[model samples]
Target: MRVQLFSDIASGAYAQKLLEIGEGLLGTDQDGMIPFTQQFCHAVESEDELIEKVFPNMQQNIVDENWLCERTILAPKNETITKIYKKILAEINTETSVYNSIDTVMSSDDTTNYPVEFLNSLELSGVPSHKLELKVGEPVLLMRNLDAPRLCNGTRLRVTELGRHIVKATILTGEAKGDNVIIPRIPIIPNNLPFNFKRLQFPLKVAFSMTINKSQGQTLKVAGIHLGTPCFSHGSNHSAKECRTPVRCSICKRTHHSLLHPKDANSSEENKTECVVNSSEAGKKQQQVLLATALVKTICRNGNEYSIRALLDQGSQASFVTESTVQYLGLKKTGFTSQIAGLGGN
Candidate 1:
């Protein structure tokens, strides 16, 4: 069952070439590394130039829903995306509406511990901001799954009307295209935080530009990527590492990516050489370990406080500190020997 409908969407050679590179098939050299390239790779110098290249004739088609729906700019971070959104929004001649969120701590006892200002300042992933700025006719993205198959997360929409309590938007993407939906102020709680808090705001973000991770599964006629910051996560690293454009390191003046430049260059180079020499011998994949850590202040025997990174192990019944940290803190320790379980329960 060959489906020509979806296959026909990426019929162009350029689009197919990009798709192949994304699938890790077309852009690498014979050694499966280094100097990745493709036919459609284009580089821009400045942010202004990048925006101009992506959204040409911006003033003429700023309000065109069809024009806006077909194009978007993606960036590695939300801060960079917000800057791009502001730049594009400033050019459009429309009255802007500002909506502020009501933030509150989940527990009344923690209200004093976590002030409203501190709660509002938090900008977590998938959570709406404390303050939202909007303009009629501009595009926005749904941050929450309001109605499945119509108003779901990542759904792009154009603002048709803006009010104090609610926003009326027309769906620009998916099966609900051209459908006008009402978005209301709703309570949103983020799950990945240490403390609990609730923010009452419209579950939407300005979609003139958005994070690269949010752009996945979206089919756009024109797309611009802002690589002002290097992609750090595994998913983004794979997506953006195909560009062959040489980036110079500011610290070492080397022909390598900025993220690869280490603080101790000499030691890093030696480690890299050692790894390359042992590459063939290490055929098995290494397991990755994730530890929860926090920076806390430790009081020494002399009553001096020093900040140190501490690993948090909730499952362990006993706590352990490093010898260096104990020495640095000048703390007295009584030695005790006990059988300890190691990796693989040894």
Candidate 2:
């Protein structure tokens, strides 16, 4: 009863194999790493080979919106993306248009605090750069959600014409595919920044190459991945569980992930000896464990202050103070009992 299929039988099987690889259903080598097979390696040996394979006739089909829409080059970092973009742009014999943004702080008096030079240098996520360089027939991706169903965010477009106030582009995907639209200079305020500032520029970036994260939800007929640097997160193609390579812990010299090693296991033998001391009254040796602690002043209900030592336990679900310190400061206590488990279910 399915109305349509997004992929063919061959592509569907290929995607299933990728899912199996990611889930660790496929067997690994002694190092716990997946062996590279020709069936799975749809890769090129060099960047030139990749670019030529992805875009066969760069100059001829550079202005073809349909051709550009079906292909993209994905990289792990923005710097690699920029390099790919410049390489692709250089192949096309067209005049480049440089559009500089008018950046200003929200507060007029705070202009000195955040200069235009500083703002121009910043390259925040989900925001276009201060200098937007483009050329006619070049593909650009929308950065903001301007108009849903027509010019929404992530919508790929090809530049038809460039202007000082606005740029004319044709939509390459969705229901409005092949439809021409105007992109104007909009005030973009990055929400992730600490201060408020406005960047007045066209919300578009060169889509000849883009970061892998930005390529999510996008289906391309031809795609090239630039692995100049190793991906640091699970979102980009691979996860830690899918890794077949064995790792060694630096702290304990154990054959496991370094992050799984205990923080206190790095203590020297001398430090361990100092922890054990003989008690004068009981004449028995007692071991004292060191924990992270912080000294702070606490104010009670009567406005009286008392200095208290607080243990910093990142694994704890709730904060706790000693009963003697609470009673001495005349602080109200809430009675709530909860079962807690530690290492080895203790």
Once model 2 is optimally superposed onto the true structure by TM-score, how far is the C-alpha of residue 203 displaced, in angstroms?
A: 0.5
Instruction: Tell me the TM-score of each prediction against the true structure.
Output: 0.61, 0.64
lDDT of each: 0.74, 0.75
Q: Using alpha carbons, what is the TM-score of model 1?
A: 0.61
Q: lDDT tens digits, residues 1-346, model 2? A: 0011123455445645654564567888998667766676676789988899999899998867778999999887888888888888889898999999999899888888999899999888778888888999999999876776577667899999998899999999777898999999999887667789999999999998888778754668888888877766556555546555565445554443333222233467543322244344465544333344556898888998878888754223345667898788897877888764432233
Q: Candidate 2: where are CA atoms >4 Å away?
A: 1-7, 27-35, 233-346
Error of 1 at 55 (Å): 1.8
**Model 1 lDDT-worst window of ten:** 1-10
Q: Which digits, one per residue and each the tens of the lDDT, describe model 1 over residues 1-346? A: 0101122332445444544454466555687643534446567779898888878888788668889898889888999998999998897788999999999989899989999889989998888999899998889988876776577777899999998899999999888899998999999987788889999999999998988777755667788888778766555454434555465545554443333322233345444311122233357432222344567987888998899987754223346888998799888989888865422233
